[model samples]
Target: MSKGERMKTTAREKIKQQQAAQRQREKRRRVVTYAAVGVVALAAIGGGWLYAASRSQSEEAAGGDQAPVTVQSDGSVVMARSGVEKPVLDVYEDFQCPACKQLETVSGQTFKNLAAEGKAKVVYHPISIFQREPTRGNSLRAGAAARCVADGRQWLAFHDILYKNQPSETVEGFKTNDLVTWGKEAGVTSPDFEQCVTSQKHAQAQLSYADKVIKEQKIEGTPTVKLNGVALEGNVAFTPQQLRDQVTKAAK
Candidate 1:
């Protein structure tokens, strides 16, 4: 119970407190190390996923093997594998038609796939059914631009681009510059193509062909799909999976 005894007890208590603090610090360092490791593991997994997604996108952009596109004398485009011909699918579409764009959004790939597999001969008949002002012009110009590149080996790509970039019916769109730019984007660099798009060289011919088909086939709408000369119902025409099934059945 003297001064020396009291000093010794205080020093022992101080050492215990320091040891507790050191243990707390070690626990915190362990927690931080585990959290950092977890974060790195998650980041590595995310990076792998991102890389896979990027590669998939690149493959899609490359646009793997497609069927041959032949421009008939009548201005319609026929796509099919070599020497394979049956189950003709006639697609009548207007570039400015919203419903036609919707059809393209849903079943465009089905058409391409069918033709690529040599299961069907897909005929693209670009038409202008709009009688109104701006919409009519847009349809004509886009249809003519399509014809300009019908045999340019990029027609399918250009066709998709047009529908992807279709503007409102009230607006004046599909201008010559945009058409030419899209043609270039579709890999059409010929001076003849530029001139044809600029002049809308095939506009009258496209109109005539559309008129002929409309009268002969009794076509009433923009997205009129006929498989093997029989009109496809709306339910089967616009749905991608159903369209594919129908075509496959027809092929068999």
Candidate 2:
């Protein structure tokens, strides 16, 4: 090759290298700028961030105060103070649903607090809304296990444990052994409770009841919170303080 051509090739390679270096510099600058903006935004919303964190923590701290929980014949769990039932809060939820988990995290304690205070009757309808495998099975098993102990003293504790241990939708979870173990942790010492969970004794019943309620109530999704038989708006249903306010208004 000629020296002139060689020199030209060398110059082009140098230019390409310089251009690549410039691009890298620009990318680094953009990243730093974005990080700075993120810091400013976090600082601006610090209060909101703290509130969100506290709300999540509240779920971990719930279940201390609850009224007597009674399991109805149809597999629904009812929580209410004696003879204090002016307003009813029906919470329809699928154990395997992510949004249902979020709703529980936000307002589960509110349900207990309301019922304990004789403010409302909180009826928990654990249903299976998942159509696919793994999640459908998981929901059924979990719902059945919850029903197994619903009549006992540990129903509410087991209910919270199920939510805390909810698995992902794509994979199988809430295995029989885990259910039994969690039941024991929730104070279910009855041998029948373990057998009921292991054998999935209430599985078919739970499925049938879920289907019946879905059709009768025209429920389209999980985490359906109804106040006095009327569905609550998303904003009110998912917010704990808002739910309390709405229940107070209903009681009055």
Candidate 3:
């Protein structure tokens, strides 16, 4: 080919390379701009979610429509009698806890029997993990309702029902409505009990109790039993003999 023709072809290829480079630079700029917008959008969404979460928590803390709870003087429910001293067994439990149910059905009865016989005393320090799955009693709500029902006369029945219906954590089967029906079946006559359960107002005091128990009692797990401040670990299968033995050991 002639020199002039070859020179023209080379110049055209150089111009094509320049155009490609400009297109590449523009593409890079567009991608960077898109990424910045995405980051900004994500930050906004995160902020909104955080705000909503805080609001929900605040509502739960307020526990609308529930009456206020008065903390017991000794921080326990075990009755104290003059000159009796009532050798105390303090129990911290979660209503959803299966092991807690075991402790109740097997060992708590023995302790209650002893208390009934005036041989000892028992104090229940219920820790509310009410939101935890399998909380058959929906104890926080139920306890609050029962408090309204028995007017403080039959808290024990409320306590029993909470444990009796504890559902499995693996599945969702416990009916909050059924708990109210159960209370009525047990002879409690409060019409507003169901409302309290639905509103989750009863959980307020329970949440407060949990905070106190964790901070003061240093409780890390459910079904923790303490006799005069000494902690009990394991299921502690409740039989008259086992409870009697543990109590005897703790008393000493």
Candidate 4:
């Protein structure tokens, strides 16, 4: 072939090669775009599925039949009672408060024993004192959920479970679903308990009760103990033995 013809042929080949390369690039771009869209779609679907499952569980819990709650005159959840003549042992606590948790850990069983033996009646007033960010919302929700548990006559067990599974103070940890899970762990398997917890059914009532007790009783903080309407000396006013002794003295 002549040199000019050869050059023209080479130029045509280069153009063809360029077109092929462009096509390849476009194809790869399309693949990447499609893959990205698929990822987003899958994520959305997964998120929706999770949300639906959570809602279904909550609904099943709420719609399930359960017994009614028994409210005390002082707006406390009666955890245990031996008899009408038993001295009243009122306990004001916040679920999210570490101090309250500590008090429960230390004195819970003692109080339960006292109630069982007709020495005292233990009344739990779950209040919200940690009304700051990250803890307040969950605290109130858990408190309301406790009321639900009380309806089922499992308030003390569920209360102990909550303290046992207490999360850090920095994060809002008691998600409604989590509360239901813990309630189940605490032997609250009924649908009514789950529904009440998930819906936070007694949230407003709990808040009002807390406020009323706080105002009326002049409560300054949580884990406040009262023996027959008089506040205890301090948080550690009673060891197990000391509590028993005091109850014995009060009974006589």
RMSD of each: 9.4, 11.0, 18.3, 18.7
Q: Assess candidate 3 and give its lDDT.
A: 0.61
Q: Model 4 over residues 136-197: C-alpha lDDT tens digits?
A: 89788888888786443566667888898888899878889999888887787667887888
Can you rank all candidates by lDDT, best first? 2, 1, 4, 3
lDDT of 2 by residue, 97-166 (tens): 9998988887887788888888899998999888889989999999988888855358878888999999
Query: What tens-digit string does per-residue lDDT give for candidate 1 at 172-235?
Result: 9999999999999898766799999999999998889889988998999979999999999856
User: What is candidate 4's CA lDDT for residue 55?
Assistant: 32
What do the candidate models score in CA lDDT, each in turn?
0.85, 0.86, 0.61, 0.74
Give candidate 3's error at residue 103 in angstroms: 0.8
Q: Pick the candidate with the highest TM-score.
A: 2
Model 1 lDDT, residue 241, Cα: 57
Best by lDDT: 2
- lDDT for model 4, on a 0 to 1 scale? 0.74
What shift in Å separates residue 250 of candidate 2 from its native position after superposition? 1.1
Give the lDDT of residue 193 in candidate 4.
84
lDDT of 1 at 141: 95
- Model 4: weakest 10-residue lDDT segment is 58-67
The model with the greater TM-score, 1 or 3, is 1
Off by over 4 Å in 3: 1-76, 79-83, 130-153, 233-239, 248-252
lDDT-superior candidate, 1 or 3: 1
